[model samples]
Target: MKLHGYFRSSASYRVRIALNLKGLSAEHLSHHLRKGEQRAADYLAINPQGFVPTVQGDGANLTQSLAIIEWLDETHPEPPLLPKEPLRRARVRAFAQVIACDTHPIQNLKILARLRELGLPEEKVTEWAAWANREGLAACEK
Candidate 1:
């Protein structure tokens, strides 16, 4: 198995954790996100989204960290990531989505880059990120 990812990508970090938990070791391939290596033609051919944490194995190419982790859980099944019960599993997934989808995006590398490009002041950007994180966490806690 091969994992194509940037070291600093949260999505990639999650996948790496899952792989470790499952006792699965994949060949690590780094794509420099800051240098736009992920947008290169060869990488884009495999992952149209140009995002990190793409796994190539079993004649399948998988993107999206959550989906990839779930696939690993399904295929490995030794140390399960999700609960066996359906409702509990749904709650777990929902909690993950709250962090991955709602919180992380607001302060992700790409979004922060765009914020800089748009001339947002550094202090303002920091404040925005903190606010987003706080709000998301508060909602998840509730």
Candidate 2:
């Protein structure tokens, strides 16, 4: 297995933590996003989304960290990450999605870049990040 990821990407970090928890061994291939390595034709062909944390498994490539983590937990069942109860599973998934879908997308590099391109002040950018964190935490608490 090979994991294509970027060092500072939170999505990639989450995957790394999952892999460590699962004790799964995979080759790590770092794509320097800061250097625009993800935009290269070869890498783009591998992941048209041009994002990090792509996992190459048996005859399949998984994008999206949450999906990859789910696959890991499903395929490698020891030390289960999700609770067995259906309600508990739903709650856990909802909590994770609060951070994954709600908080992460807004503060992602592309969104931040767009904000900067629009001449938003650094203070606004900081505020945006703080807002995302606050909202994500609140959602998790619920």
Candidate 3:
């Protein structure tokens, strides 16, 4: 099993935590995101989306940290991260997605990088990231 990821990515961190909880082991391969290694041909061939924390195992290549965590829970269910009850499980997934999808992505590296490319000065870019984080947190608080 191989886990290809940028070491500092929160998404990758989440996947690593999940793997540890599940007692699953995988080889870690680093793709330096700040250096744009994820966009390289070889990495893109593995994950066209070029997102970090791709899991190559069990005859499958999985991307998106939440999806990978769900996969790990499904395939190796002994130490289930989600509840068995339907409503509880739904709630759990919903909250997790709220953080992973709604909150994190807004201020994540990709968005920040794009903001930089759009000619925003460093101060504005930093402000944008901070605003995104605060707004996302406020939304989650509701």
Candidate 1 residue-wise lDDT at 141 = 85
User: What lDDT is obtained when candidate 1 is compared to the true structure?
Assistant: 0.92
Clashes of 2: 0
- Quote the positional error of residue 44 for candidate 1 in Å: 1.7
Best by TM-score: 3
Quality of model 2 by C-alpha lDDT: 0.89
Q: Give the clash count for each candidate.
A: 0, 0, 0
Off by over 4 Å in 2: none
lDDT at residue 35 of model 3 (Cα atoms): 89
* Candidate 1 residue pairs in backbone clash: none
Estimate, for each residue in 27-140, the C-alpha lDDT of model 1 and write its tens digit.
999999989998899999999988898999999999999999989999999988889899999999999999999999889777887899999999988898999899989989
* Superior by TM-score: candidate 1 or candidate 2: 2
Extract clashing residue pairs from model 2. none
Which sequence of candidate numbers ranks them by lDDT, best first?
1, 2, 3
All predictions: root-mean-square deviation over Cα?
1.7, 1.6, 1.5
Mind giving the per-residue lDDT tens digits that candidate 2 earns over 1-142?
Answer: 8999988989999899999998998999999988888879999888898888899988888999999999999899988999999999998898888888989988887787789899999999889988988988886776
lDDT of 3 by residue, 56-120 (tens): 99899989999899899889997999998999999888878877877788887888888899898
